[model samples]
Target: MQQAGIPTGSTRPFGYKDDKRTLEPAEAAALRKTVERILTGASPRAIAADCNKQGLTTTRGNGWSKETVKQVLRNPRICGYRSRKVREFNPETGTESVRVEPVLDDDGEPVKGQWSSIISVTDWEAVTEIIGRNPEPGDAYNARKYLGSGILRCDKNGCGSHLRAQKAPASRKKPEGFFYYTCPDKRSGYGCGGVRISGPETDEALKMLVISKHEEEAEDRQATGVPEEWEGENELARIREDIDDWTERREQRLVSKERFFAFLAKSEATERRLVNERNEWRRPVLRAKGEPIDLRGEWGDLDFVEKRAYVEKTLLTVLVASAIRLGGPVRDRLTPIYRGED
Candidate 1:
């Protein structure tokens, strides 16, 4: 007999109806028990092994396989939720079944509409979160393009720079229709006595060690791995630790209670400092690193919070020096990192 309208090499006629369907209540109950067993630490492979050993057959009466076991686990029918979407192939069109799954919840969980749910809402959430990480189509994976746009600093002293975007001719034949970034201040801005060079020229001039810092950060994250959530937890733990230590010292009479209260009064100040530091570490280091540039689409596409993140990542320091010389030495004085001028 054929299952899911696929030819099973069996002598089953098309459109032949069978009273014994696999999605019945009894099958659902059995499937639920099987799912519960698996969730309680039984591996899918092991469960498949046990099912095959017991001479149990899938809907097609075929021997159990690990893949089938996984499909069953993911199926929602066992949990009394019917799957809304079922595959129905058009024999004439030779088209595959289309997905009709609905957004299960606001968190993007899949809801049961036709087949019963074998997994709980929580387990479903975990699986969805894992799967969601797989990058989708149209997803460009480069950090440097946008982050380094305005932030890359020119190491040249007097020319301590801000990025300048200008269109200049690349060659005689082609009008180089590309964004060329350079140190605006270094090239010919205030106090910058250094020679103003094009972005492509300066890229060649910059030291490899300085340029590679951003690339190293990106590569290291890919290699060792970093979780997005851990950063917040780490900061929270540090804050709590500091608070606890202070409290303990005061309670144990090691530090006077008055001193402890005084410190408490400054808690908001400490919090502001910590918040600034958090923003700093997460900030992108913008410098030419011979890395692939990744401008993340248009600015209008980005939301406000993301725009702020982009600003924090780029736009390093604004150096203040004496006067710009026509062709003299640039000072190396480092000024305050611009946090946006008032």
Candidate 2:
């Protein structure tokens, strides 16, 4: 077994060292810090860059890459556990694989502490499952598709400045085909004094706003000294445990011919809450994995209403003073309403 890449002794091999042994507390802490950095908004590439900047070496003594970072994340040893499998290839028969049962104690639970863990077992599972999703274009539903659309309103109290479109000619020879947005209150007999911006110009402004907002949020997180990588492992573990307990209770009631409806309701409620929490975590991860918005490319895919909604959501209202009509296609000019922090 030792000659076949299997350990013969009681000690387990660690990736970080040439001679494998259980991780010491200091090594565990370092691993945890690395995991926390990855859990934050940083991409694997970014994490690798940071680690290299700090002069840290991987188990192979080489600089870390995104692939290496991902591999480490997938390692079960990080959860202080190990897995075993046996593979066999036959000439007559197809290749076959077998997983040896875990070296269990009297209670049948797998042994623990084979290595250090950056995150808890439960949290690690959640993160790996998330990493398995498709990342190609059109595989994700982006939430920031709306930037300058009229649907986005001032988050302030009682100052909901409405937006409306304006039509203008692109050239002297053409009669129409350009459009823009402005404060609807300016024409609705309200006291909204705003300027007009061209449709294309407004689109550009909204795109800039979206990019700027992303930057601002990142900066805020850095400024507050907050731990960007929160350990959701506990919450996830609790949710799973709750579901299992509820399910067992529900089954017992049904088997005993007693009222199982109450147990069923409790289980359903717990499951719903867990699902909601999971979705919340998933949305940001999905967004982070999404491609950057291509203003020109996406325009042809959306019509007036869809474009408007996309703009409204993506832009900060203050950045869009108003949409004004400029020379372009027939429906060009628009006035944008900007409600800054006055």
Candidate 3:
């Protein structure tokens, strides 16, 4: 049964079908998108809030939470690998412990499962790096209170540091402190230290840009289509089989040690190239249906967290130039660089 490659559990995985070998299209796409978001520095807490706001539920029909999202992100099953819990008894300590580990093949590689992967194995490992990170302190995982706090960048000549949200010193017009975006001199390391703008004004201007850009992309995406299955799958399998065959031949003394090693290196290099192409070809399709036509209308009711998530999904980074004057339109010193830009 261990080598049969059949999923033993009755419950279907989050993004797969009942058989556990077929993808649930919508759920799989969502999982892929979530992985991409997490890899791009979206906090799990913020993602959970956004999921709940959209009335989305898990495969078990349970409401999303920070832990649940993290659990899914750390699961290797999403990337087409099988894992099992092995119970061990320590005679010296007289204790029993259970731990989960990925099932490996003879060559010490994780056994690939039947279900299509939502993301590449490399991406899954990258997401797992967040497991030990402190979400409160690190800029990548830290949750921002302002819409463009960490998403906006300093467009200085050689410095492209992210801007932080902070309060301005109290003044006559403002009783309390004024909120604005500024490049952190300490954090930026070598920032030019001249980029600053009103937080409220910058947020307003960026919000419009995100919505307008999203609508424009959506219009173009309607004509785009997902391609057929990647043709390189067979090529990849053949390469692996060739590797195993050569490995066996070397052990049997049919080839010289150096010759076998050189062949093995070349095989691994070709395999890597094929795997890269396969991964890029299988990127999650961006469905045009069910997406909001105008995010501006929904902007009024959204809280700060939701607004920030919306902006992150649409814009790659908003580059803010140094203010040229005392006061002007927020759009004047701002430049928006949307996602997918070269």
Tell me the deviation in Å of residue 243 in model 3. 2.4
Task: Say which prediction, candidate 1 or candidate 3, comes out ahead on TM-score.
Answer: 3
The worst-scoring run of ten residues by lDDT in candidate 2 lies at: 131-140
Q: Which 10 consecutive positions of candidate 3 have the poorest summed lDDT?
A: 133-142
Q: What is the C-alpha lDDT of each candidate?
A: 0.44, 0.49, 0.73
Highest lDDT scorer: 3
Residue 298 shift from truth in candidate 1, angstroms: 56
Off by over 4 Å in 3: 1-63, 77-81, 85-101, 109-140, 143-168, 175-177, 181-197, 229-238, 247-253, 284-329, 337-342
Tens digits of per-residue lDDT for model 1 on 272-321? 56655543333222111122222222333333334434355432443333
- Give candidate 1 regions above 4 Å deviation: 1-26, 80-342
Candidate 2 Cα errors over 4 Å, as ranges: 1-19, 24-27, 84-113, 133-208, 215-342
CA lDDT for candidate 1 = 0.44
TM-score-best of 1 and 2: 2
The lDDT-based order of candidates, best leading, equals 3, 2, 1
TM-score, cand. 3 vs. native:
0.56
Please, what is the TM-score per model?
0.25, 0.40, 0.56
